[model samples]
Target chain A: MDRSEIENLIARVALKDRAAFDQLYDRVSAKLFGVCLRVLNKRAAAEDAMQDTFVKIWKNADRYSANGLSPMTWLITIARNTSIDRLRARKKGHQDIDTPGFELIAPGLNPEQAVVAASEASRLSGCLDTLEEDRGKAIRGAYLDGETYADLADRFGVPLNTMRTWLRRGLIALRECMSQ
Target chain B: MTEQTDIPRDDDVLAAELVLGLASDKDVIDGRRRMSTDAAFAGQVVFWQERLTAMTDGIDPVKPPARVKKKLLAQVFPKTRVSVLQRVWLWQGVSMASLLFAGYLGVQLLEMNTRPGTQPTVLAAQLVSDTSGLQVLAVVEPVKHEIALRRISGEVIPNRVFELWAILPDQAPVSLGVLPDSETVRVLVPEALRSQAAQFTLAISDEPIGGSPTGAPTGAVLAAGSMTEL
Candidate 1:
């Protein structure tokens, strides 16, 4: 679904319209599920997180429009945060030791399809291309994999402070690039 | 860096760190404290979250198992659509009836206690909360391993389930399963716990639908009382 359609469905959902909620689920569940999987890195946990995310979306639909964020962004945020919460709630000593490489963006896309994917996607891709290669990768790794500074430091073979600096500067640069 | 430029810059970085999930648990808790008390800090966190979320566009979508959707629907739209207040009213009505029944049962028990021929096997307790003015009267039949719970007063938080627990002396609370939504609920005390019921306290806690996912009480203990043999 396009952005406005998703927004409209969410508006109806705020009114407790069950059909609209079902429609919204059909349209976004896969993408949200992907977000959950990427952050959690476990199928069963991701499934649980995905289910909880939708329930949270249903209960907190009223808190959405007031935030002034795009529907997809809002939805993704919920999924990501829910997954991260699940990750943190795991056993105290548990850590995701495996460092998976970032998933490459889709290889083949016509210009029409790219435009239809939402300008935010295109804009973000363009901006990420402008950052230093390793810095960009670190930012992507941190967000997509729920990697902590310690995890990134180990992956990049950098001191903890250096890893923190890379991420901090990379995020600032991203903000600047996206704003332009 | 001079202290002048450092503060806001540090806040911005902290916000970004929080949104990106890169902060340590301690830092995340501190950041959340700031978010609640500082609007600008919260907005910056939202800004970073919105910007960074776009990168997830490349992650290929995978359809979740069908059971997830089924379970989600079942939870959101349970068969009974009783509102909390309505349930409370219903429970009150049931409570009044149970009180009368308990009165009858009490008289019968008194008579049974006075009788010379047979012995009766029944145990009872009253769980009360002075702050909320909540009361629950529990009568147990050890042989049958069942406890009848009657809500005497107060109501549970809407949209959450109440789970009954057996808090044994010097032991952690053991779940007795979720209380029924109605005013009167009959719960089969778990076999392992039946013999120990009289030695433990009965408490109810507010939990998410389907009870505590962790198999333990995660919410507040709304009411509790020690069991007393009648």
Candidate 2:
């Protein structure tokens, strides 16, 4: 849905519009589910987080504002934070969720098909190209392997501070390169 | 040579650490606290959001169990007076509660205006943030001024006066002014802040019931807004 339409629905939801709230749920649940799965690393846990996030959104619908951020961003922020909270609660000494890296599924594809297939994959590949070797590896290791900074430090045989600096510097470089 | 600015130049670095989870427990705690009050850091969050959001794509989509949605539906459409999780997640934050309260009040005021024997000309509204997230701490929008504020630890807001500060990215916070009266304070925003709504904080401080003596925040913060912009 567009911004104005979403805002209007939010306004109605603030006024206790239940149908609008349902519509809002239909629009963003998939993306939110993806975030939950990433953090929780389990379908059941991710589902739990999604439910919690939307419930929080429903109760807090009145707090929406044009001054702060877009409605989608607001919903995503809620989902991300709620998932993080669940992850914190389930602290099994695991930080990152175990996930696989992207690969080019089909080599020769049409333009639209190619985009549909590699939208994020292409962005990651491009952004990865601009990163320094070690920083890129550090980010990949932590994010893909679900390794914490401390864990990464132990694996890399570096101090915690040094690992932090590497990850921090790596992210900055990636953000800069991608923003352009 | 030494730099003249007090802004943390390593903010991007800090943001990176945050995404990488390389940030220490202190960084996460401090970042969350600062996000409550600091507008610039809020913007930094948005920037990081756009960046790290792509990383989420690597995960394969999984269909969740039905019980989850059933429980969620139960929470959203609660049969009783708000659920437990709702109160904890929605109301715990200083800004979120205030904002929801203001919105409730705004809806009431709007409803009242729509009643018979009333002639409403302009609509007034206030936006508040959830304490759980980086958001506006408190907001009271009258006819003239839209009073919005975020939480800042150790920020001093005196009895009568309100201290206003402009937060900039990679720069020191600049003072806007002290709110002399509670009526409607229009803060003259810096040019840099015209495009930055999320990184600046408008703090109200207690003074001699008149204004600030030192031209900066002199008391604890009464209200503030998360610097996250639309």
Candidate 3:
């Protein structure tokens, strides 16, 4: 998908253009549905999550530029985060990830850093492999499985403190490897 | 919900934890607030979101079911264009059955080109309706076996064609044909219904571009009137 085309559609959608919104849905829904399905791991839940994702997209497209994420990243984040919210909602007293489109623009990455970050994003898979196998699984399980620190501690049979320490080290190592 | 006392809270790791949803519930809330004020923290959070999101790159796109779109459109656009305009059509007066007849009468008169008062129409009906600006004058020319119509107000809906229907006393409506987007139209009277032309009620229905596929009128009846002898 052409990044500019998606960006153009999001800009048009921000203006409340229904035709552009429709086109945008057609262009991006499959990829978003896939992301939702990966996180939710159920057909019905994923479908509902995808629906909610689009509703958010329509409501939040105007804020896309202000959030300063790539168009696809912004959208997939919504889908992923929405699906994870549903996954965690099954557990009582759970909090959702930051609502879609509300991601604060990080100041650390300049345009050049952003280019580096984009390349780093592509390095993510390799970096995951470079981490200790258990750490890699812990990261994936927390992200893809919506595992909280307590949940990870339960799953990995570590104390909650140990789980947090282990996962933080994994993230630090992964970040370092990607930067390299 | 208190900050974890495990290790010194590394901002980069905390940002990663927040993006990964590993943050404690209270931390999730606190982290989000901090991101707004601390651009560096916010930037790290965004950077992590970007990097973590690529994890789904291996997931194959799945085209959702067609019904999903159907249900979504229904949810999003609950009020159809017609209801949004609040433009109801047909029978500002007259009983329901007879009102439906005006569509039939209009169908019979649709093809004849009779000017008002040129010669007395064998039959005529003035079609008007509540919540509508539609006013059509239809007349049956007996000799030509045709119906002549003059639209005085209202309009053809964009992208929608208007259809003419003929309704007899108790029978289902029979389609005349799709009406052109013109002020005046001439429609041939169906040979079978000519005997009941005086009792015919003509109606106009809003339909798709090529008109209704089901021989009967398939859309909202916009105008209708029962025929009266000149």
Best by lDDT: 3
Q: State how far residue A66 of model 2 sits from its true place (Å).
A: 3.6
Q: Tens digits of per-residue lDDT for model 1 on A1-180?
A: 488899888877766666788899999999999989998889999999888888888887766662345678778888887787677666475332211110101122234433433454457778888899988888887777767778888999997877777778887787677666
Would you estimate the TM-scores of all the predictions? 0.54, 0.48, 0.64
Higher-DockQ candidate among 2 and 3?
A: 3
Per-candidate clashes come to: 0, 31, 29
| lDDT over C-alpha atoms for residue B129 of model 3 | 72
**Which segments of candidate 1 are over 4 A away from where they belong?**
A91-122, B1-9, B80-230
**Model 3 Cα lDDT, one tens digit per residue, A47-108:** 99888888888878877773446788888888888999998887888777748666733344
The ten-residue window of minimal lDDT in model 3 chain B covers B82-91
Q: Quote the lDDT for A124 in model 3.
A: 94
Q: Give the chain A TM-score for each candidate.
A: 0.75, 0.66, 0.94
lDDT of 2 by residue, A1-180 (tens): 487787777776665556777777666777788778876678877787798787777667766654334455556656766676566555665343111100011122334432332343336646876798877777776544346766788988997766666666666677666655
- Predicted chain A of model 3: TM-score relative to the true chain A? 0.94
What lDDT does the true structure give each of the candidates? 0.71, 0.53, 0.78
Give the top-scoring candidate (DockQ). Answer: 3
